[model samples]
Target: MKILVYGAGAVGGYIGAHLIENGLDVTFLARGGHLKNIVDKGLNIVLSNQEKIVHPSYATDSLATLKNVKFDVVIVAVKAWQVRESATEILPYTSSSTLMISVQNGIDSPYELNDVFEARQIIPSVFRGICLVSEPGVVSVPSQCSWTLGEFQKNPTRAINSLLKPLIGSKLQLKVSIDEDIIKDLWKKLALIAPMSGVGALTRSVLGVCLEIKELRNMIEKAVEEIIVVAKSQNIILPDETLENSMGFYRALPYSATSSMQRDIEQKKPSELEYQTGAIVKLGKSNNVQVPVNSFIYYSLLPQELAARSDLR
Candidate 1:
């Protein structure tokens, strides 16, 4: 199978390296420093159990090059903000039968993707893994990894098995669930991540840090409530017991674990304040839900970073 990894960051790198090992032809669409590094040293992926270095044919900074190319599947691993922009690149690489899987954070991606492509053509997928770009060409993280694929409508059988075929002898975790509540699951996952990561990123705190302040703990609880409210308003059915799930994950996760938001804040790079805290505010405003706390946290925490990214890039 021919595949293209549009945003070959940590998640893309992890999946691509394994796909290369499994003997499928893969290409990575990358640019700037990361692309430069990959061209120079190939792609490096370090999992807890194993390590991978794949040097497949690569393109540096151009999706138009993919215009003359063909791909059976295009796995988009770009950031949430980059999704629309990145999907545009796939126009050149995609054939009529190309399958697009959006394994992203926010719930709105599928609809956005469907605006350009058919809904039946987009697979609602999510990644339940911890991956970090430790350095250029090097993606490393601890080994609690999971990847799920499902159709947004109601069935997974038509959408997932062919994607699974490439995984027959690979070191990849692939699963197909027919859950009608995939969106709810995605929101539930975000609810957990946003509160934990948004609070942690805003405070520069870790999982262990949330344990210190009863007030912050309460704030975390409220942030989660805001997410749950939005989820319900969107007509997604969250598990009644879903509230504790995200927080529970925080407790079970490594104390030192930090979200991508926290990492971006520390690196002085652009952060996902909108999606985590910002999504809460955006969705809340539409539903007439007052998310003053998240709004306060987002507005207050983001200006500094906004000014900082300008200085850097």
Candidate 2:
């Protein structure tokens, strides 16, 4: 199967590297210095266990080159804000049967993809890993992670299995599972990530530090509760033990663990705040649920994000 991975950042680059390493038909849609680095030195991935440099079937920045090409599986691994832009770029190359994978970390990404592609054509998945682009064409994975993917409205189990066949046995420290209810899974992940990222950025502290502080830990729990309420209002009933389980999960994480949003905020780069905590606040408001904690987090971070964008432009 021909696969196209858009945005060769940390998550996309790492997944694409493993797919190429296992001899799959993988192409990367990259641009800027990353594209140049891939063209000159190939793609380099530093795994938690080892390192690999792979040259995939193709890598390109220009859409004109791929005008006639067709991709069976298109993994949209761009950030939440870039989903619409990425879809506009890749839709021209997608046939009706093309399985569009939403690998972003937000609730609206699936709907964004559905605007251009059919909802049934979208496979919503959650990426559970800490990865980043240390440099152009270089992806650093500091821990093992997994992807929980499933059909949103269409059952593409067979196609998903076929796509996952290549990485059956590799040292990538990755796992893939099919979730029967992918939307619920997405909400569950959001419960964990939104609070963690919000509090992480707001406090400018790592996971462990956030948990160690009494007030911050309490805020984190309240944020999770708010998210659960928001999810329930949308008819997605999270588990009763979700908050506790998520707290346990975060508590077990290393002391140095910080969310990517925190890193982006610290570096003065554009962040996924709009999709992360901001989504929760919007959903809560629509549901008439008061998410004061998340609102505080969202509003507090808004100016910094706006300033970052202004500086970039």
Clashes of each: 0, 0
State the C-alpha lDDT per candidate.
0.74, 0.86
* Model 2 stretches with alpha carbons more than 4 Å out: 156-171, 311-313
Estimate the overall C-alpha local distance difference test score of candidate 1.
0.74
User: Model 1, range 1-313, lDDT digits (tens) per residue?
Assistant: 7888888888877777767777878898776787888889898777777676778666457776554677887888887767888778676678777778787786777777787777767776777768877888888867566666666655445645654566444364423343345677678778877777777877888867775688888888888887777777878767777777766776777778888877877777777666667888888888888787788788877776677567424
Q: What does the lDDT read for residue 266 in candidate 2? A: 84
Query: TM-score for each prediction?
Result: 0.88, 0.93
Task: List model 2 lDDT by residue over 1-313, tens digit each.
Answer: 8889998778888777767766779888888998899989998888877888889788888767875888888889888998998899898888998989888887889999999998778989888868888888888888778877888785544565665455444447767677778999999989999999999999888888888899999999999999999999999999999998898878767788888888999888999999999999998888899999999999999999999889424
